[model samples]
Target: MSIRILTAALFLAIMGLLVAQRFSLPPELTVRVAASLGEDAGYGFGEGLRRGSVVETGDGFLQLTIGVELENLDQAKTILWLAPNTRIELERLYEDEMTIRFTRGRIIASNETDVPLKIKTNYTSHLVLDDVASFVNYDFLETIHVIPLSGSVQVNAGSSESLLTPVPLAIHETDPVTFEKLEVNLEAGDAAEFYRWAGVLTGL
Candidate 1:
């Protein structure tokens, strides 16, 4: 073979390998659709999600509508229940670490093991180290609600951060005029009702 042709073929082979490695599915990060309700329930990567199918957000952003239970099999079994109008993308899903970004709506993440889970919104981020179950509602750009079922939650808003208990509170971003973060506690029965509404939306 000519030297130029051989060199070109080698370069193409290397590029193909690099692309596959970047986009290939991780064997450790296994996901499945445990339960799906509603007609809009499907994979964000196009086409409907099937049982035991590995799901990735693909390139760019992705969203999940009502009645979707995406389960991740790691040391800690994680179940993500999507409420209505919930738009989210999984940035990483590993045995010890996981990151999920929520664009809007609500999602309930149930972690059965001790793996660390982190959730992100447009203006804020939350790290779940102790809490196994947490609910995040990104209803608006300025307001976010966080409910930690077990342990505590670390709330990060811009440069400031706070530790929250099981109080079920809402974090409001501090506007330049106010220069103060706001947290609104939910009413007594409102927490339960919120979960109930989420369940109803997901048809759980």
Candidate 2:
């Protein structure tokens, strides 16, 4: 009888440890303050975020001057490289899909996940999985621009959803907010495109 009791106790202990580990793991959607050149390094918006933290669905960010790097560690292998003056939110986080709503500005998305990775803007929808791309949502007079870097980004404009596009393959080097980033001579743009790049600081 004592042996049976000991076995049951061991089983319960193991189950309790598993439950605690699952709960203690980092939130699936985690936020890391993007690197910035200036002292005011982080901006907060939507639902009184006030500071960067794990985001659940419906957490909106606006005019994020300091930029925020988001990673979906559990549900997806993805990261969003945000530019300043960007507006976005964690729109949906589900088992089969993950989506980020881009209201304005730009993003450099790196998505390598099995789940469908989608970005929705006001006018279009994009599938950016299995690739890295840059997406612009028409700042100022410019229209939505898509520039794929390594792999292809599937775009759907004027439909019910929106996807993002890439900038000049060389755009990553001129990170407007970062004072010191690993210099990726990853792009070369024209004079006009370079001019537009200046407005990235304020998300114009």
The deviation in Å at residue 104 for candidate 2 is: 1.7
> In angstroms, how far off is 13's CA in candidate 1?
16
The lDDT of each candidate is 0.54, 0.49
The prediction achieving the highest TM-score against the true structure is 1
The digit string of per-residue lDDT tens for model 1 on 111-167 reads 545766678776677776644444555465566777665666676766764555555
Residue ranges of candidate 2 with Cα displaced over 4 Å: 1-28, 34-76, 158-186, 189-204
The lowest-lDDT stretch of 10 consecutive residues in candidate 2 is 172-181
Q: lDDT tens digits, residues 1-204, model 2?
A: 999999999999999999998786534543343323222224432222222232221222222211223432234356565554555676654445667776666666667767656777654566877776666665453345555656677766444433333333211112121111122222343222322332322332
lDDT of 1 at 97: 60
In candidate 1, what residue range of length 10 has the lowest lDDT sum? Answer: 58-67
